[model samples]
Target chain A: MSHHYIKTENLEYSYYGGAKAIDDISFLITHGEKVALVGANGAGKSTLLMLLNALKFAQKGTIDIGNTFVTEKTAKFIRQKVGFIFQNSDNQLFMPTVSDEIAFGPINMGLPKEEVERRTDMALQRVGCESLKNNITSHLSGGQKRSIAIASVLAMEPEILLMDEPSSNLDPFSRRLLINQIKSFTHTCVIATHDLEMVWELCPRSIAISNGKIVFDGLSKELFYNQELLNECHLEQPYLAKIEQMKEAEKIRSAN
Target chain B: MENLDRVISEIRGIETDAIDRGSRYRINPASRIIVCFLFLLSMLTFSVFNIIDTIPYAIIVILLTLLVNIPLSYIFRKTKYLLLFVFFIAAFNPLLDRRPAININGFIISYGWLSFFTIILRGYISVTAAMILILSSGFIPLCRGMEKLKIPKLLVTQLLFVYRYIIVLLEELAQIINSVKARGYGKNKFPVKLWSVFIAQLLIKTYSRAEMINYSMIARGYDGDIKTFSENKWQRSDTVFCIVSILIIGFLRFFRPFVFINNMF
Candidate 1:
């Protein structure tokens, strides 16, 4: 409903014993845009997502999500607009069954039983969980669990979808299906993934992180070709991009 | 193929499980508690002329245990373990009389020991009956059945918490074992002191992890109790199941049928 979906000004967060997780980062995300957060393990991607949810407090600087500054009251506003997807969907899908997990958020919000049921159905339908309504959540495959996890948050009807490592551990086919699901959503999305192809396919903009700092934030293609930047930060240049670069060099050599 | 479909439906579908047979014996958990008392009291108050009384009650309780689906051995094992606390209860039955010579066959020995054996038999039978009731109904449906009978939500919550968290703790313990195993500490590599040391480390790790999870759950707007969305309408089958169990228990309790020649003894 509001203009700016998310805005952070010089945001900094440190874990216990003064281990900085997000070091002086700032960004404004507009509504209806998709951004990929590209980073290695311990690169503070999940930390930043946690801050957006008001699950973790900012140690320094300001985060304003939907006109509300990130504070104790931030939960009221942030939770309505921001839906967080954990990397291990296993944790999110905690209920005995799929429909139960989908209904969990709505029920916790204390909606009418009828409305909760309706929301549960609608959310499951959105995630193509029609045949799985009665299936126990634990029995679901890795990718299926991830889909249901997203559906659970969707039941709450949050405006922004912030996911951590969305493509991790999914088979190639399931990964393709997940990308399709992401493209279907109109909500503003900040997805963190190790899959370079996924970032290219699903995210128009990409930001790279290293050692608790945003090392690169640019258009996806620009970040892809920045070989020196990638090498310095211990990121392998995406294979497709490297091949393309080699092809370009070959073409130039032949022309010369 | 037809038989296979039937088999699959029976095993796999929740719908099949939901079907209810009409049961006259579908007593509320509170009523069931009263039933348990009536069962024990009537059996105790009845005048027994010989082995007929004791033998019949034992057989009836065994049948009930079968219906309850609790293994007889499981009941025995639990009772055996519980003997520590009640070991003195037997002494009172015999110690009050000190030592009286009792005639057994032809010889007379210590009468106190006979009293003690009676006490042990009585305790064993009583615990087993209770165990059968618990094992037959299972914990959750029993809780639901109790809830339907207007048992307070607070009491039901206690049962739910125990049912849920015990399993979670067990699973977490398993994961801790796996992570330790993955770190080059299998049966062959285990050091002498590490057993106690690892357990201590696990305690600390589980405590901190629990604290973190508590924070995360709170952030998700989890107030004291989580709501379960699915409260299905009780099937006719559930009613029938309850009824069938009740009828069998009732027949075994009050009726003095000499179907077994062993009952004569």
Candidate 2:
């Protein structure tokens, strides 16, 4: 089992007394693969991401992360291996201060005091938030909170990163910074997002889901070009892809 | 809606005061808790008729409030709402016990009135002391201090959650109220018919938000135990402060300082 490898088979989940959120989802993400899980709202993108990390257990299916199978017993171990960044940074950060927020995961993992301090500092620096170490988590701006949320999970040193709508509610600059940060990570990342431009840039492969089922699983370019699939999944083509299309059309017109 | 906003901001302000390092009072959290507990206990020991005797406790609370650099007005503002409830509870005391206790210049003061005054005084002192403790040492440190004092982890965790989530809850509530007002349902007062529906909606939203927060907590490898990055060490100043506070509290509990002062005057 290669580290950072994630595979889910026939995954299914349903909210209590509610409709199924995920149905028969199957995908294999190899080590260091950057994959985008895109779908319409109320689709299973978030649930699928949760299942990958075992934050939400599947009603019926199997999830394999590296060598460990995700079950109730292995959920703790799975969390250590997979770091989840929630869509709402507020929900992700609960600590009083930034340093405490970052150190929380490491400390909870029972790391030694020195190691916890080292990891907390390193994570703060990683997120370029060293100056915010003492700032209150709730008092921080939206971008700062999001960065700290990422740092908080990064402190645990997980092999796989699962982010849900990482770009939501962020300004342009913050979104670009986040994109660059995610781009630099070597760990396998599965981002569930509606940001098509982000998917075009960061993810080589994109998986589109509609009505709790996988509609398309292929390269991002192919998914973007399939207008019917994009419409069905409630996705817009990336602006960059549109630019490329216009450029191609311009060249053909000149040749004619 | 404005009141809710003020409440939230006031809570945040107190939280800021607790975590501020520039404040002169930096007593260890555990020592502050101990001193506060002793102060409250001493205040509680006074009988209802011993209103004058409770004066020393009130004075101590005022002095401590000044020492902690918290403004008197700020304390008054934070505790005024609570004091109103205390007033209601103490209002019955004067009505229930009408026996004459003190006579000054032939004007009679009933034991009930004295008890009422004493209850209000006690309420003010108790609340002021608690405010001082929290303002001196922030919420997280206070929880840590409580844990050090052998308080159960479950209770400490609950306290911390309530403190943290109160802000979130208030924000959620503010949004609901704003939306309601935007829809022009109630400009002066909330519509009575919408109360049940609004409350049910808030409850459902709160439950779902709680579920999300719980998931976030578990995703971060949270076991049953809550841990902190900063471990507070007991210091010499803490020990000295604790000893002096306890002695003062004990002296106030035993000696009637207000009566002595009155006699001298």
Candidate 3:
């Protein structure tokens, strides 16, 4: 009896009197599905993610998270369920201390102090950043900041996570750390990233958007090998996919 | 750019040092806040010329600093700029009044000189008390103390936001300045006109970043109200500290012990 955890119908949005950032897009994510959102620059992946979080309301569409519709009345409730991690860790980690940053969401939800503190500890442990509980946010390195940002989102215990460019500015070690954490999550995750390697490893399903339209929607395994569609959407085949291609060529040569 | 870095580092150093000090640092922030506030108010009640009467309050500040394990040298190092600014402001007092007020050891001292010295002493004592408050309570506790004292919630939260973002803004500015230097724009010197442009760009970037942060906050269930984690509570020690400090301030303001000492002499 699994239903769509997140559903959008003909989503369209514009930015401040400019052209449409998201135009005529529709998608549905089932419970516990990790989907990768792939697109070129200005292809509206981020705008769509914001819509899902209800950070921005669509001018001409509807969004539903779980059974609740995303409207003015339900925005607060929806936000508590959909946690968003922004692209820039600097923007996300605004609190003075790491512990405060993690507790902010729960505190805002009107949770009791003990509950908030408990969630903060749990989130820090889950991210393997327990040692940073007392560290100041500004003093942390880039990797530490990213981990704390993720911990902040995780502390809310959200049912769905919307992450924008999670691995964009991270070092390889940090990226691997993040990929493993995302891999362990059972919640519905929709990640908008340029890191196709992350897509290959962490996401089972892939959705590609171009000109604010979903150009491809299928398994990551199928989408990576579709050279024509990857080129059309201005995405490169992931390194692992290229390795797989080389292995196929070797096998053909040995059989010949 | 280096100067900016120095200022930021200095502020950060002061903040960190304030939090990591000794036994007084472990005192309830509310109690420390109440004591420091009473101390400040009692000093303010002294007549500007009643410099001798303020000695007890100054002693209280010194004792508190010692109790907190914040070194006198650290206070002077952090507050020298403010102290110098105060000195310059009080410099004109000595030139304005010419009436001879006191004859000390056959040396005539003008009222102007008397007021000048009084002003300097007042500035030193008051600024020193403020620095000790910062060192003892730290910024977060001070904000919480203000909240407990029934300051407007909006104002208290705004104070916290401003304090947190001041560092963020300074860090952003430092990065931009460093980037400009890295680009070979100005190595040793920054031109005023170029700095103007850089500042304008910084404003735009800050505005956009603030917008993004606002959205992120909304996405995390912030509903125009900020709720803070209440980590401080009133203890028996806090009550004793507050009541005893208030009584002492009342005694100093009313008794004028220095006046009695002068009459005895």
Candidate 4:
């Protein structure tokens, strides 16, 4: 069976006469592969994810998700196959309550009421947010809101997940909770994030984007040692890696 | 800033309390709608000088408020600004008409005064009834009630989104205002010249936020239709509540029972 679940060839997008947001980007993800997208501010990581979900149409080139080309006609199908979690949980969670947020996607898909409720309950349970089932979305804390946002998209049961900055502004506990949840997902995942710690822990492969172009794509461990490449991409090694280097320097000093 | 915080707290209080199952107002949203509509309709049907007719309606409002465990003082506080508006609109009634309409004891009551009093009564009843509905039914149930009443689904969805986004807009505005304050902007009396520029920026941010919301919705399978889970069940008590309310309102509107009772003494 083919492993290339998503393939974009020479994809290009410009934002409303502004400079190119995405330029000649091409990549492929195997089935069930977890990849991290790292970049500095103003990089095209978010734009690329949006293009994959067909939230914004590319100005040039093709996007094929699960063998279906993304177009206006096929956008709905493409969206069904690719669930997107936005950077700001507030932006994604507009429903009144946690249960409503979870059921929103399933209900919009025209599922039966019972099925929608079942999926909503299941999703809430999966994220350990079942206690917030009836809580108003606005009253929820930052962590609860993020969990509910993920639950909302997960209720759609998409094959591929495109997450934008999934761990930004979360408390340490919630951040660890999110990492654990991401670790448990078996679906094909592409996460765009500034949190190199999350990238190191969750993704085996890494893709670095800079100025709307791919700067590097390879094994996650290999990318950590490439200081020049990391500096070019405006990223740093994971915190744990930095701690290890500090410990290694102390040992060298002690031995000398 | 205290005023803004107070307003936000009031809204949050309403949102949380409206859905309490222990509250008497937590009846079927559809039944609440029917009663609210009938109450408004019956109150509006009274003659211009039928101030006595609203006595029963006022009693109903008081009873409902007490039964629902909502603070009467809170309702009055919230509606005071609206009462000011209603007062202004009816202020001209007494000046516009001077013809004598009735004699109370030795004094003659002018037709304008009678009508002015009636208008004030009407405004009070209508506004209080609307507030009761809102406080009792909450926003989500009210939308569900509208949906069950055969209102256009699009309009219902718009109402829900508007209610949800208004708080977000307010919060976003608060953030901008805080940033401006940190940067040495105006305090109480803002500069009038900057109003247009500030509003324009707000509009742009609102537009972009709306686009992001729409994109998120679409990604989750929104096909121009928003669907929500409504567990509102219509019980037998809802039917009984609807029937009893209609009959009482019908009596008070048509028979003028308070007037008869007043004459009996």
Task: Identify the runs in model 2 with alpha carbons over 4 angstroms from their true place.
Answer: A249-256, B21-23, B95-98, B185-191, B255-265
- The TM-score between candidate 4 and the true structure equals 0.93
Q: Give fnat for candidates 1, 2 and onward, in order.
A: 0.31, 0.71, 0.77, 0.90
Question: Which portions of model 3 show Cα errors greater than 4 Å?
Answer: A1-4, A249-256, B10-15, B22-24, B185-193, B257-265
Between candidates 2 and 3, the TM-score winner: 2
What would the per-residue lDDT of candidate 2 be over residues B18-103, giving only the tens digit for each residue? 67742466577888888888778777877778887888888878887777788999889878999999999999988899998989
How are the candidates ranked when ordered by TM-score, highest leading? 2, 4, 3, 1
> What residue runs in model 4 are displaced by over 4 Å at the alpha carbon?
A2-4, A243-256, B21-26, B185-190, B231-233, B260-265
Greater-DockQ candidate between 2 and 3: 2
What are the lDDT scores of the predictions, listed in order?
0.70, 0.87, 0.83, 0.84
True-vs-predicted CA distance for residue B62, candidate 4, Å: 1.8
Q: Give RMSD to native, each candidate.
A: 7.0, 2.2, 2.6, 2.7
Instruction: Looking at model 4 chain A, report the run of 10 residues with the lowest lDDT sum.
Output: A1-10
* lDDT of residue B138 for candidate 4: 82
* CAPRI grade of model 3: medium
lDDT for each residue of candidate 3 in B30-113, tens digit (9 for 90 to 100): 677678777777777766656678777777777877877777887788778888988898788778877788788989888777
- Span of ten consecutive residues with least summed lDDT in model 2 chain A: A92-101
Ranking by lDDT: 2, 4, 3, 1
Comparing 3 with 4 on TM-score, the higher-scoring candidate is 4
In order, the interface RMSDs are 4.4, 1.2, 1.9, 1.5
**Candidate with best DockQ:** 4
